[model samples]
Target: MMLNDIAMIAIVGAMTGVTTVLFGFGGGFVVVPFVYQLFLRQPAIANNALHIAVATSSAVMIVNAGWATFQHQRRGNVTADILFPLTLFIGLGAVMGSLLAGQLNEGTIRLLFILYMLVTIVDCLVSRRFLKGCEARPLSMSTTTVGGVAMGAVAALLGVGGSVMTVPLLRRHGFSMKHCISHANPLSLPVALCATITYTFDGWGKIPDSGFIGYISLTTLVTLVVAGGIGITISQRYFPKIPDWWHARLYVLLLIAVLIAMLW
Candidate 1:
């Protein structure tokens, strides 16, 4: 890769880190499209560029989500009882999603990703309940098992951390934006870790490339993780200071911006 490529990676990595700390994204929303666009022109990996993008996004999320979860826990943002059980279901779903993804065409998967993102954005905007915060209610067994698993499956398939869905789900269920994002971090961790493992092992010896292990581009993964870590360390101070209304508005705006960028 050229120096300019590295520079672009670092730039996007820092932005990913900022989003992780502030929106609980774990770099998926940013990483998937950026990496796909960057690698699509390379003849060797062109056909599998979307898979590589998703796999690499998952690898990046393991670090971003894990680190952000730790920070959120420190602030008493994570609810342990709900988190543990939900994580189990999400993990199971992630493995399922990862295995199924290899059977899909790259264009089909990309289409799914974009469509899901559009739906999510529209859901948040039209709901009208997202900005009004309420006390968080207990998770029903069905929501924990069925919803968690579905979220994991979809997030794994799309290379997202599931924050886009979780945040809105939690918000609709009466969570404040601050705590919703906090909970989103821990919830995303399992999805990332489980998906990464499946992607790495599933694609090994199959991709026909030197720089990739499975669908992951190790060089890109390492660079993004390191730069994202630095970004988290630097930008975390801005997280707690935002007001709830502004926070919720910004979240929607960010999703809209990402949607526009992806479509363009």
Candidate 2:
């Protein structure tokens, strides 16, 4: 990679790392668009730019999610009871979502992503009333499984870490914002892993020779993962100081920024 490209990756990675920990997302929301823009500048990967961007972002999430999960666990934010039951269903859903993503064209995926953003924005805006009647009861096994599958699929399709959906659902089920984020952090692992593997095989022979394995750019993955890891460490150290209301506001701002970037 050129020095300029390396610099770009480092900068993006650092920003992504902070966001990933701060919001409990896998950083795919930020990574996907940035990587898509970067891929657009590379002729060899231009034809499959969206796929490459999504795949590479998912791959990077493997590292981001793992580290963030560890940090959350250390702080006693993760609830094992909630995490264990959803694993299998989430994995299954991730595989299904990746398969579906492999079959769609770039335009369709982009449109879906935009629509998802709109819905999430609306959900966040009216979240208080929407969750008003929800009981602080334990989620049934069946409900967890179904929710896990759906969350995994959508997350993979959009190149996210599943927290965007997971957090809202958990919140409605009476989980605090912090606990929701904590649980959502670990769920990202399955989605990222499954989607990355699927994308690798889906574009195996179609893309040009561009230092890629299928749709994943090795250089981008390495640089972002390393820099993002550093960002996560730094962010975790200061996470306790941030209030939940501030976190909510930050998430809204993030979604708005991403929406504008995509439209722009």
Tell me, by TM-score, which candidate is best.
1
Give all TM-scores, in the order shown.
0.95, 0.93
Badly placed stretches (over 4 Å) of model 2 are: 129-135, 238-240
Report the lDDT tens digits of candidate 1 across residue range 1-264. Answer: 778988899989998999998888999999988999888878877898888989999999989988888888887888877686888888888888888898899889988988998898888778877876766687789988998889989999898988997899889878888788898888888889888888888788767768788889988998899999988988886546788888888998988887777777
Off by over 4 Å in 1: 238-240
Q: Please list all clashing residue pairs in model 1, or write none if there are none.
A: none
- Writing each residue's lDDT as its tens digit, candidate 2 over 1-264 gives 579988988989988898877777777888888888887877876768889889998999899988888888888988878887797788899999999998898889989989999999889778882234245668788778888898889999889878888777777677766777788889899999999999999989888675889889999999999899888888877656666566667777888898888777
Residue 103 local lDDT, model 2: 85
RMSD of 1: 1.4
Candidate 2, residue 38: Cα displacement in angstroms equals 1.0
lDDT of each: 0.86, 0.84
| Residue pairs clashing, model 2 | none
